[model samples]
Target: MHKLTEIIKYSYNLNLLYVEDNDEVRNSTMIILREFFKNITVAENGQEGYERFTEQKFDLIMTDINMPKLGGLEMISKIRETDNEVLILVLSAYNEPNYFMESIKLGVEGYLLKPINMEQFLVVLNKVIQKVQLKEKSRTYMSLLGQYQEVTDNSLIVSKTDPTGKITYVNDEFCKISEFSKEELIGSNHNIIRDPENPKEFYEEMWESLKGKKQIWKGTIRNKSKSGKSYYVQATIKAILDADGNIVEYIALRSDITDIMNQQKQLEDLIDFSIKPILALIEIVDYNNLSKFYGHKEISHIETVFANTLLQSVPNKKLFDTVYTLSHGRFAFAKDANNQDIDEIIDNVKKALHNVNSSSFEIDGKVFDISIRVSLSYGDDILENCTYGLQKIKKGHSDFFIANGLAQIEKKQAQSNLNTLEMVHTAIKDSKIISYFQPIVDNKTKEIVKYESLVRLITPTNKILTPYFFLDVAKKGRFYSQITQIVFNNSFDALSKTTKDISINLSALDIEKENVSNMIFDLLEKHKKDASRIVFELLEDENVKDMNVVKNFISRAKKYGVRIAIDDFGVGYSNFVRLLDYQPDILKIDASLIKDILTNDYSLSIVKTIITFAKSQNIEVVGEFVENEEIYLLLKELGVDYSQGYFFGKPEPL
Candidate 1:
């Protein structure tokens, strides 16, 4: 009982895997383990235990040594091949020299003799638990240290020095850029590459900060290379302190910005042209500092090569083609052009730039692959529009735009959408979005067969608004999924109240997103008894880009006895191929085909063809927008299985 208290206090959060071949021992031990551990997984033998270890993460593993299929020593050895950190304990009936030595060789934390002494077992278990706590602490520290090392190695010139200012460490980046070997840099003062541009007071202030052992000191510094070349670095230096809080060393991280400084005027000169310039802003996506993978000189040369490619590939170069380096990993191009020829020129440039960006280059037997995001603008305000276009692309939208009157109107609409989106979000949060039911009836019997659930938003003044007023705004922002969920819950609640079947609409985007799709499955499970009466009304005109996701959703829903119906079947990309692929249980013929069926023979023949084909596949056809007795009687005479519109009943609050 005393050991149990200690175990619960120290090891209650840990997950353990217990492997024992004896069923009686495993069951009894598991019951005891369950008292202490938050989670415990039991396996019959070493082989099964090893499989579980591969599938899940465990804090500790305890196994009997002489288990069948695989022994404790063998499993531990296999585990050590990949992970040597997990604590392992072995229980054995034999305390022989061979078993002890093999266990030691496999790095088992503890070897306990079986027919257990509970007190001694607790002592060893506590010791192993302490080690586990220490390992976890070290792992967190190591993770933080690794992150710092990655940033320093990939993007900065790094160096370290002793408190007395003698160099102690210099990374390869510092060595390559300074034209000094590691051996030559060590033990030398940091002044080896110091340029004479800064006044003496600059050095005085730096020294004062270092002597006071302040936190980080940052400034731009000029330095000279071995070949008498000058460069600039944005440097940050910090004191590294020991456990006693005394400074032991100083570490510095620097970014070389000499090329960026040199190229600023070139970019300004290119942008000073009077012609209507078409600007293309090219941004590097996978930039981890090219200098880390290549020497500074080689990186500079590669940028020059890329600039030349841009100059050559842009269409109609003779009509004012110019390239400039905006900054590290970004470039801008300007071309003088007439308005009529701008679109074609931009298209050719995009194709050429895409080819360049997609290809990889080899430098010094190492491969450098590049990916880029390109944005384009064609107008007098080229630079501003280019920036706007780039922001759009970064937000995962279209990358190219013409800064015309239409674009300004779209910008206003987007801003207006933001205000409307807040209202939609509030409606969802406050449960103001409600479902309205519209009935679909049997064409011959005229009895209600199913009700389609439509969403309505209640305004602050208590006026009700339909989906057409707000759904587009919901899709444009992040509230579409939330709105879908609200509609789903309201529809399901209505389904629970009545025995009538219900149909709810879903768009292609809802099916495309896994989270929304999973929410749908959860809702189905919540109403399992009435799932058969629920029909998913998908618009036939909506584009199904990911057919596999759609197919999987259908197959899973069908397993739960839910029905599928394609709405608006005669409009936009609808055809028999989609019908053959999905094989839905109901086809709701589009309103366009039915509204004009009496006057238009083409519409009549199409409806006839749809009904004929649906009959062949055992799929019921529903005629939509049936407004009058003549159209209703014609649909009934035409053998339509269902009808819905004003003729049946308008959508109303349920």
Candidate 2:
């Protein structure tokens, strides 16, 4: 009680006058108030209180309504005439309706009755303290706000919006970042900051989190700054709340560190330059950075070492590229020469390098030993004008012979990839290719609703060759579109009568070709009835490399009502979050998992998970390799809606 009274006591330079006719009540209150308050005066009667209150410039006036002479109500009304900002409170029997109604016009902040409970008095007194502190805090906040505006007004982006996530106010920086001016963006959502490369999942996750009461969130954001310049920043978003605990606005603080990001990139490039050509069989796929493998400084050092060794070695008729160690003890390569017998070439070169090491180069301080290999191409490896056939030799492996550049098989495989391309081309020219069908069944209906048309080239020996034999090669050459169109036409002709839809996989390469869409639309127009019975199976192959192309193709394809199935679903590096972007009608689950769908719980779980995801996206599921009764039954039980394989039917002559 005492502490609360002391805290509420006035401390300003303005005058304070307290009136209480009771001697004890007046004396104690005056002493406590005077201890913390300045310019204090007391009046025994309402008359004196009014006189003193009018005489001085007071900030607060407290009095009992039951006081003598002029009475509290009359004194208060007179005081109200002189001041409005001054806080007024009644401390006596002030519960009467008339007294309150009249005092209300006097702006009394609080009123307490006679014989006040100490606890209630303390609560009311603390409220007065709060009011004073609130006024002081408000003034301080205003001053700080001015300083804050000065510090960040020019650099930071400031935006204010109503509770609904629409933009209401945007500063210069916000306008600069979003490229939309205050006028244009005021009613827009914050999506203008979105980047093309950003995955959809991040936004989905963000919105999900934002809907909750989370105060702030941290995430790496990629946004297009006003001038269509993309930048990355670590952003923190905070929700500004009102007194009722409802979010009224959101503030985003983003710092541009594009230079720091670029420096990090350079540092990564430097690291790659130092330790590449790892000689280890681990696949490194940072699709953004591939040229780092060609380490200029290290490669040059290796070349010099090999060059010195070549200079010292006795010249021979067999031309070969050779590498020798130098000052850094790092060795590299034999330059591809015009006439190098690459086979005997590597051995003689190694011998020459060894000879130089033994005779002249010293065993220097902390020298690193090095091993290298060379490759050879003689007959078909050579193009019509070119002479030698060594495509590439990896200076790696457990095979010591390979280290010594004597791996005959390494040279043979290079010969095969080169030979395979020609063989595939010759096969296509000869019309050895045959169309095969992989029945695509509706798992829910347990029937073949579609057939995914596959292309195969059967050798005269009756060996069935998969499309892999020629597709990659054909895609590289100009023959892909012809083969795709032929397959499409053949499949349509084969299924012209059946109610079942025939899906044909067109290489994104086919769609990218000139007149592909026109040709398809023309073909479909000729077979409008047949086209509805067809599904153009889309694969995220070459098209996935550029999303805009894929989106454009799908958007155009969708207009034909032919239904699009994402072929080899969940098998590629497609962003699953953006799966909705393609809006596929069917998700042809990849055969890699379908091949053993039943026995492996892991594969079953994955298929089930994909089905659940696809269901949400309104995509039908199709199983490819339903080879046995058990597999078929298991997939059906596991909620797989489709089954197609030897168990149901195989591709036979139409």
Candidate 3:
């Protein structure tokens, strides 16, 4: 009513302590408090309130000052000694100057008159809530900023040199990159890392560029580490000036670019031998789309198949030395063959790729075919030419070879993927990824029975992105495992506090990874007693190559009283015998089968068969995507135990 929208939302999440001596007043105020805060701790007097405060944390506090057995001021004094940030609101009957001064000195949030009027109380409460919210937001912002800063600092080689070019300071990253200890670097000349590869004129030009305090010198520098190993860095070096506008010191920030340089050299080596090196860039087609349907491990397996095909097709090991994968969905290789013979080689490679493309990848029992497109370049600069060809492929010229005119694309898709991966890493590092829950209701009783936990990426832009959008890139970047761990820990911890069961989906690839598997088992063990409330749903599409691994995981998980469910039961292999062997507690009929179940007899038949089979095995059946009352009622008649869909409720944050 007061248009206090921000404060109201913040209050719903915060915990508050209200301390008062009078029972009637406390009860009356608590009725209003319950409408705002989710958790409210009440105490009879200041001493008891202080004890409660010590045991737990609260975002805000409200207390009456004139209470017996230790007044609010004395208790608050004790609290302020240990905790200065918790917002405190004091209620008092007196308007005494001394009381106001003492309260202000103790940093109390507000002083309100006793026999509190509802309208006036809400106004003061709103102000205090705003303060609490602002402080909380500030803390969260600083924490995430700190995490990003730490990552950035750890990655870049940082160093400072005095005007005379002697090293004044160096970060651990600088020492690490240079393979030198801090002591070895601090007093050393900056030229200690200079390499012979750079000409004398290059140093002269750089010094001239830095003659002005603000002029930034940027270049690729070849430097030798302490071990005498040569490396290259893309560096930005500039002077730090003093009040007099004179250069007092210089600072440099650089990133290692040795791999790219090595790749270029490898290309050059092939060309100088008169072998007529050709660069071929292979990209996994629809890799992001595939990741939505599959997992990272499966994607890796598919890429391996593509590589093997390339080697087999080319057969001339001397011509095609090694196939290097740059990132997920992208690969590069060089062949020592001239343009005259390149056509025939391309035909052979295409044939091989076609053969592999005909076959399908089986992940979590689900089978799907993957295809790759190739771009070839015979330009003088291998890296540049290859990247140009890659750009062509990205622009819908995939599966073809190019021999000329290499123009750079404005923004490379691979660069975009890299940026997304960085954001994901930052989110995970800051604990910003979170779980959203959707209700699963009993079909017959029409009562919510459980929830399905879905993971979301909270982007730096404050936009919420679903798994299908970014999960593929994350999986390719080897970040899927970390995300899985975050979702598991947060979801299971939340489930442990409630009686309602919740289901979490896990990829077979996730289960196959020893580290991720162990983390899941550890969480299960931690919530062992409440394990019955946890359900692990494995999609039926993925092929479990190692049945024993899945069996072992299921057995151990079941031992903790957790239940297993076969998700999307009608998709992929859909093998009943295999399902029987896994003996999942719940069979979630695929949405594709249920979406058409009402109008398509074939879909209905499949659903009936799945439900009948599940019943025979004493497994409960859940029908997904039951959109309308007709489907809901039909599912109830078909003996479906539970149903989840937009009809019930969309997935939401808790």
Candidate 4:
């Protein structure tokens, strides 16, 4: 009774068309139709029904198999030529299988007897309503998904593999980053780009998480390009599961973090290397102040001429092995004090500075007199001592300074770090960690659909600070997880009061921690009704230590109807194969890509590809950093489903 009532309610809003030549039969059926549908167009014959269909759209059409001026089957056949989606029903006295077969061939929704049965008619009507409603819902969902896929595919490195780990599909980003053509990757094993430096144990652990445990595998991976050039990626690998929960294939989503990895390597190399003794630090006195009189280009030219003069003025080039350019118009000349005493090396550098200070430097078309301050230091910690002596020269009325021992620079640095650590501790203890809500708008509708929760910290002075200021310090002090907990809890509390969905940012490290994961699960259980509205945005900046843990959390959260979104996708470290494990509901395109989409061809191409892939997967995409009207409209034209940034509104307290 409930189902029938619901069907009748749905039918009320639907427009239907009825056609019959028999006056008694048509009038009787019209009574039944009028009961369910208010807007029904009655046609006397097949020709009239066809004309009514052409005039306006109808949800359901009922006609007799045999009718005058054109049979009912003939009218339906004509309607099928123009429209394939409308529901059709046949009502006739013909009991033969030939009539039934012919009606079926005409794509009739149901074939009833001359005298309609009330129960039978209602049941058939219910089925038709279900079909109509399902199709309409599917269409809307796919349209949204298509837009998201376009944005996601363009921003991330995505690829898919068969059940046995054979490459099957690769997006443009995957090929561009890996330096392999689609043709080369399609039939090859995933190991084609694998860097041998990654030990066998690494692969073992990854497979154990993905294949054996049926979980996601995430980690930083070193891979070789097609030309054998090494590159690094933060990878997420997962097994794609079928409706029956069986493993079907694999997908990997990766972000290219090669530049970040290289930078880290460079910093480590610099730290590991030994500094040369007998260092001389030289700086153009009041170099920054020179910007007041000269343009940046002229100032730069002046610095270049001064540096060249100092190098050329050196009596013997062998005295200084290297000349290092430091910031703010400073240079460091360093060499070993093996056989030559510190005094001798210092004297030689003194001669170079004397000659440079006395010379008239020509920069561009102007000649200017340049004076430099020199600091000389030897023995252990030559760099630090020379730097300290330079600072003294800048303050005091002196052109020269010599350091005999270590300065208090290290102590000052230590004190600064300690101060930052103390600030982090105080913030955490006072429950100062909070989240700000940024509106995410639908591209087409230009309306706010959801809000992304951005983490912010309040200082002791009550000033709000973004994560950029103190997040790393908090991590160093082991308070990073606490901040995540605070933000997650606050976002859920916000979700309770609002009808719109709220997205909370999270990283793999957060999932690895038992306490954080436990809190998240508990919250979902505590607010079961709001679970459907909560979105967890997985941050791709950090590496995942255990893919299984993250995957398990995702799987569990999904059971509560919580959605997962990949945050900052396409800037780096995305894999399509890994998407299978995470199966994200949304992909938040990195701001870097979105900001440059109009000007950068690569960015536009990447966004388009992401949207295409997202459409196929039925995932939504949220474009970040939509700062202006032009960008928002372009995203809509490109079929991006949602957008987020300052253009709609900056992050604010909700």
Cα lDDT, all candidates: 0.78, 0.60, 0.77, 0.79
RMSD per candidate (Å) reads 22.6, 28.0, 26.9, 24.3
Order of candidate numbers by lDDT, starting with the best:
4, 1, 3, 2
**Any idea what lDDT model 2 has?**
0.60
lDDT of 1: 0.78
Q: For residues 1-654, could you state the per-residue lDDT of candidate 1 as single tens digits?
A: 246687788778888998899988878777777777878888888899899999999999989988889987888888899898888888887756567656766777766666665655676678678778888889886876766577567656999999888999999889978999999999999888888787899988887776663658888788998787998887889998764357889999887878776665565555566366576777766554444455445566677776766667555666445667655577876666645587677777686567667687654576767666777776655666666666677677544444434356557877788868988888887788989999999987999989999999987778888988899988877788788888899888888677889999987557866678899999999989889999998865436766777888889999889889988886532233466456699989989989999998767866875686577667898998989899999999999999999988999987
Clashes of each: 0, 12, 10, 35
**Looking at candidate 1, what is the lDDT of residue 8?**
82
Tens digit of per-residue lDDT, candidate 2, span 1-654: 247446544454446677889898887677656655677778888899887876776656778988768888788887778666667768885455466545555667656555554444455555555566677789887876765565454554566666677887877767765677788888887776678788888877776555563447767677886677888665667778664446777777554545446644543343344422111111111211221222223333433444554455635634423232321122223333335445555565456545544453322232423332323222221121011211222223421122323244456755776666666666668776668876767666766777767787766567777877767766765666677777777777866657788888765655654467677777877887667777877776633445666678777666667788777885541233345456788887888888867566545645765776666556787777778888777778867678878988887544
Per-residue lDDT tens digits for candidate 3, residues 615-654, read 7667899989978889999999989999999999988885
Task: List candidate 4 stretches off by more than 4 Å.
Answer: 1-341, 345-407
> What TM-score would each prediction reach against the true structure?
0.46, 0.43, 0.45, 0.42
Error of 1 at 525 (Å): 2.7
Task: List the lowest-lDDT window of 10 residues for candidate 3.
Answer: 572-581
